[model samples]
Target: MSAAWVLGKRALREGRRTPDALLPTLFIPLFFLVVNVGQAAKIFPAASTEFLHGQGYGAFQLPSSLLLAASFGTAALFLVEEIEGGYFDKLRASPVPRSAIVLGRLIAELVKAVAITTVLVLLGLAFGISIASGPVGFVLLVALTALWAVVFVGFMQIIALKTRSAAATNSAGLVFFPLLFLTPNFVPRDLLTRPMEIAATLNPVTYVMEALRSLILEDLEWGTIAPGFAVVLALGAVMLALNVRVIQRYD
Candidate 1:
């Protein structure tokens, strides 16, 4: 336990030293938020009246923006860095349990994810977006966003450890892009074409969008949020198991 805390603290310190590593996690998402919101604003008002449950497009899209901001980049970047720099080997040689190292890294990523979400959420409010779901919804947004970060980290750790290359890990992170686009994010799922509709139906990110939209624009719709959280938790378990297998194989 003490060892895990030490590892997590060390990871946080290391992250602080390299602002470049943290910048994309915040900047890229902000760029997307600005571009998407601006380009869609003209038409979004008309479209929002049809299926937005009486919310503006800016409000509808804010949750997706927050999620993107919190979710960009990989905790695997750190893993790959440590491995290439030989720091991972040094840690592996220590007497600490292997799982502790990964857990510590996961904890650090969760912290960072929450911080990013907070900043973006504040920005969303600054832009006049309001959370209709109130306190419960706000808490769930934060909680689920943190889980999203940790779940992605679990997958990232698998890729980083299995490939042992920072470049490869970075490339692997792009796989989420298609997943993000296929979701009911920018537009209502009802408005999507056949192929996109099918893809969005199958995409886990769609549920996340639904959950966030429900919270940000609706009145505490527990039905959508519950299943959305279930999906995140289930994915987190699966990815964690996969990462654990990788750690056992390599460590």
Candidate 2:
């Protein structure tokens, strides 16, 4: 555990110090936030706009950026480079536990994910977005976002371990995020078309979005918040276990 902390700190530092790590993750969601809101506001109904007055369209779609951007950790990308350079083998030869290797990278990604989310949240606030749940909801927002990011870290690392290929690791999110975009990304689930509404109802990302939307756009209700964390927690555990096993069984 001590070694894991040490590695975790080092991993975190590496992530922080690298500008590239922040750029790609930060750019996408932020870009989407601005673009989506800019276009949607022009065409959206006044009642809908009035309904989301505090954060407006930006606040409502804020999770689109928050959840999507923070969710993709470059841990796998780093692992790929390390594996190619033989540093991964050196770590394997070291006394650090296998779980530490995986968890350490995960910790680093979590830190990065949270940092990115915080910056974006602050940026949203700068544009007049308010936190619906106040201080407490802000904390929950960060934690829940980090939990979701952790799940992604596990999935990405599994790709890193099994394929050990930069190409494969980088493409992991490509396979998973379409469903996220298809969810109530542009509007509330209730506002979605019938087929899309049904899809959003079934999508876990919808719960994650509504959970976050509650903090920024709606009243914070356990009814909304709890389910998001519950789903992420349940899913995060499975991803964590699978990544741990992959690491433990690695040759």
Candidate 3:
């Protein structure tokens, strides 16, 4: 446990040293938020009357922005660097548990994800996107965002350990772009076409989006939030288990 803590600290130190790599996690969300909200405001009165459930588009899209910001990670970049440089071999030779190495970095990523989520949520509030469930909903947003980020990390860990190539691991994040958008990102699920509805139903991201959106638009809709938790857990468990197996194989 102490070894994991130390490695977690190391992961944070590396992130602090290379802010450029981490900045996009925050930047992409803010950039899109501004553009989307700006476009929405121009048509607010009319658009709100449609499928928004009587809310502005900013509130509708804020969860997606937070999701994007919190979901980006290094995808075991530092671990790959250490492996290439032979530093990781030295650590592997130590008595520390193999899983600690991956879990430690993932823990750091979750902390960073929480920070990003908090900042984006605050920014959303500043821009007039209110949470219907108030303080409790805001807290739920942070927790859900962190869990979502952890889910991404589980998948990235699999890629990082299996490929151990910086290029391949780094590009792993590209998968998220499509997963996020193929669902009800820009619009509500009710407005989605038949094909999109079919895809979204099968896609866990759709539930995630709906969960976060419910927090923003409705008061503690347990029906909406519970499915998100289930999807995240079910997916994260499988991905994390795969990573553990990969680590055992290479260790």
What TM-score, over all chains together, does every model reach? Answer: 0.94, 0.94, 0.93
The residue-level lDDT of candidate 1 at 175 comes to: 77
Instruction: Give one digit per residue, the lDDT tens place, for model 2 in 1-251.
Output: 88777888988887878887769888888888889988987666545565574456777888878888866767778888888899888888998787888888888777877787888888988997889889888988888888888887788888889998989888886855776867888777778899999888888878888898888866678899999999899988898899879888988
lDDT of 3: 0.82
Higher-TM-score candidate of 2 and 3 = 2
Q: What is the C-alpha lDDT of each candidate?
A: 0.81, 0.82, 0.82
RMSD (Å) per prediction: 1.7, 1.7, 1.8
For model 1, state the Cα shift of residue 154 in Å. 1.4
The parts of candidate 3 lying over 4 Å away from their true place are 40-47, 50-53
Q: Which portions of model 2 show Cα errors greater than 4 Å?
A: 45-54
Better of 1 and 2 by lDDT: 2
Error of 3 at 195 (Å): 0.4
